[model samples]
Target: MRIRRVVLLMAVGAALAGCGADGEPIQPTMSANVGVGTSGTYGGVGVGLRRGGLGVYLGL
Candidate 1:
């Protein structure tokens, strides 16, 4: 019986490990940028907001 309880607790812990503690978005972000300079240098930048429980993707 004690072993069963321990196994049950372990199973519960394992299940809970995959859940969010506060129930929020796993990932939310967006960004778009580009720059070109001399010597054929190129680069890009991006920005995003992650406050709500949603992941908004751009350029999809």
Candidate 2:
């Protein structure tokens, strides 16, 4: 009984400690484009942006 109480208290304390302030949710932006012309070939480009204003891109 005593051991159970101590274990329960520790579990509650751990749960409270884990409840930290939430951080700003990430808002991302993404874009892609593809085009085909008279030729039998295609091209595409993609861009991505993250919360910190960082950007990544790919093209083919």
Model 2 / residue 14 / CA error / Å = 0.2
Off by over 4 Å in 2: 21-60
What does candidate 2's lDDT look like per residue over 1-60, in tens digits?
A: 655654565454444434432654333333546667788665443333334454433332
Model 1 clash pairs are none
Worst 10 residues of 1 by lDDT: 51-60
Q: Candidate 1 — which residues are off by over 4 angstroms?
A: 21-60
lDDT of 1 by residue, 1-60 (tens): 655654565454444434544676344343545667776755443323343554333231
Which candidate comes out best when scored by TM-score? Answer: 2
Q: Each candidate: how many clashes?
A: 0, 0
TM-score, cand. 2 vs. native = 0.34
